[model samples]
Target: MALYNKRINDQLMTNCLALSNELLEKETHSFFPNIMSYWNHILFGDLILLRRLALNHIAGLTPQTLSALPTPKSPQDIYCRKLSDFAHLRSQVDELIIQYCTNLTDENCEQFISYTTTEGESITKVIADLTQHIFNHQAHHRGQLTCVLSQFGVNYGCMDLPIIVSEGSRANA
Candidate 1:
């Protein structure tokens, strides 16, 4: 799931990079306001959630390791104002997620995660569920991104997981 999400993110990043800065930051008058805004929100949310999960230090994912990652003050925080800058951080976060998942064990997944929400509400959830939520959250916002990108005539190609894996399998055969 993490690997497939990474591929989709890569595709989206590529499409975003192809746009001029003006268009990337153009006012969409949508909920996110612009392409960069959508990208920023995704990254911010990922970092925030991952940080909570990393608190367990599961699979050697120590909070100290992610200490360098920018801590967003809120969901709407824009850590990387430019798309290029966001791309760099996005790449790092994607790699971290892949590494984290690659080492996850069934035992780890069953563990409980207790973390405070962005709204300051305390919450407890199973690690497996949180992991699923991470990917799901990515897909949810990525869909919004594609919708807005479509308005600009950008085609992101097929995002279906099975299709991506099948295409990769065929290439490697």
Candidate 2:
């Protein structure tokens, strides 16, 4: 699910890259205020969740990888001011996510992870569920982004996962 989520996000990001700066920065008065905010939020969420996963020193989430992520005070913080810059950073972080996901073991999934939220709350969750939440969170915000894009009459093409699956199947045939 994590790897698939990355693929979907990559496609979504590609669509976002094609958008003009005006549309990317346009205020929609939505929960996130703008398309860029949604993108930044998604990136922030992924970094935080992945950092928590890294705390266990799991495979592919080494100290080097953790050092690569910036420390954000809150999810709403503007880490990437421009979509272009965001895309660059997003690719790096996405690669980190991919590495962590691919190296994850079944034993790792069975362990519980504890972390503090941005709201100053301590929480404990199973690794598998937390991993799902990371992807689900991206999908949630990506859905919002797509809705905003639709409002602008922009076509982002098909978002179906089957497209990715089918492509892989064809390649392997």
**Which digits, one per residue and each the tens of the lDDT, describe model 2 over residues 106-164?**
99888897888999999999888888888889989888888988998878778777775
* Cα lDDT computed for each candidate against the true fold: 0.86, 0.81
Write model 1 residue lDDT over 7-64, tens digit each, in one string. 9999999988999999998888777999998988898888887888878777668888
Q: Model 1, residue 9: what's the lDDT?
A: 91
Best by TM-score: 1
User: Worst ten-residue run, lDDT, model 2?
Assistant: 164-173
* Candidate 2 ranges beyond 4 A from true positions: 167-173
TM-score result, candidate 2: 0.90
Best by lDDT: 1
For candidate 1, report its TM-score.
0.92
TM-score for each model:
0.92, 0.90
- lDDT, candidate 1, equals 0.86
Model 1: runs farther than 4 Å from truth?
167-173
